[model samples]
Target: MGTVGITGDDGEFHLISMWVAPEARGTGVADLLLHAVLEHAGVGGGRIRLEVTEGNIAAERLYLRHGFRRTGVCGTVGGDRPEFEMVLDL
Candidate 1:
C-alpha cells in the first residue's frame, strides 16, 4: 500500500510525505494515492502544491502527468538535498 498527505493553507493545498512501499511500487499505487488527494482537493479551491527533490524524475514526472507545473521555487531538504516546488491548479 501507499500513503499521501495534504494540508490546506490560505487558498491552496499542500501535498506532503507521499510514499509507496518498495514492494508495492509500479502497481499504480502512486496514481491511486494521487487520485485520492486530488479528489479531496476538489473541495478546497482545487489548487494543490508539492515539493520534489531535485533529480527525482519519477516523482517529477508523476506530478507533471497530473498537470502540475514547477513554480521556480527552490530549496533544500536535510540541508543538502535539493528540492523544488510544483503546483497543480485544478
Candidate 2:
C-alpha cells in the first residue's frame, strides 16, 4: 500500500519518492515504508533528504515526526506546485 526509495551515493541520500495509497492512509503503511527507507539510509552516517509538497500537512507531519527538519530550500513541481526540502540526519 505504500513505498519509498532513496538515491545518491557516499552516505548522502535523497528520498526519491514516497507514496501511500489513499485507502491505506492512517493504516501504518506509510510508517512502514518510511522505516524501510530510513533503515537503508542509516547504513551511512550522513543525511536523508526529501522534497515535500507545500500544504501537504499530513506528509509534513510524518516527516517532522520522523525527525526531519526543513532546510529552508524550496522549489516547484511541474512548474507550479510549491515544494520544500527537509532533512533527517542519520
Candidate 3:
C-alpha cells in the first residue's frame, strides 16, 4: 500500500503522489488507488491530474489506459527530472 494525495485546489480536487509497494506491483493496487481517487474527484466535480517522470513508461501507459491524457511537461520541484503532466476529465 502507498499514499495517494487528495487535495482541494482552487475549489477543485487534485490527485497526486500515488505509489505502490514494490512487492505489490502488478497486483492491481495502483489501479484500485487511481480508481478511488477518480471517484473522489468526480464526486467533487473536479478533474484528476498527476505528473510522472518521463522515463517511467509503465506509469505513463497505466495513466493513459485510465484516460489521463498528456497535457504538458513540468520540472521536478527540487530535482532535475523531467515530468509529464497528465489529466483525466471527471
Clashes of each: 0, 0, 0
TM-scores of all predicted structures: 0.93, 0.95, 0.85
> How well does candidate 3 match the true structure, expressed as C-alpha RMSD?
1.8
**For candidate 2, which ten residues in a row score worst on lDDT?**
1-10
Candidate with top lDDT is 2
The whole-model lDDT of each prediction reads 0.90, 0.92, 0.80
The deviation in Å at residue 78 for candidate 3 is 2.9
Give per-residue CA lDDT, model 2, range 25-59, as digits (tens): 99989988999888888886789999999999999
lDDT of 3 by residue, 1-90 (tens): 766877776436656688899989898998998888877677756577778887899899889989989887677845877887888877
Poorest stretch of ten by lDDT in candidate 1 = 38-47
Candidates, ranked, lDDT:
2, 1, 3
Model 2 segments more than 4 A misplaced = none
What digit string (tens of lDDT, one per residue) describes model 1 on residues 1-90? Answer: 888989886568999879999999888899999999888887656688999999999999888988999999999999999999999997
lDDT-best of 1 and 2: 2
Candidate 2 global TM-score: 0.95
Count of clashes in candidate 1? 0
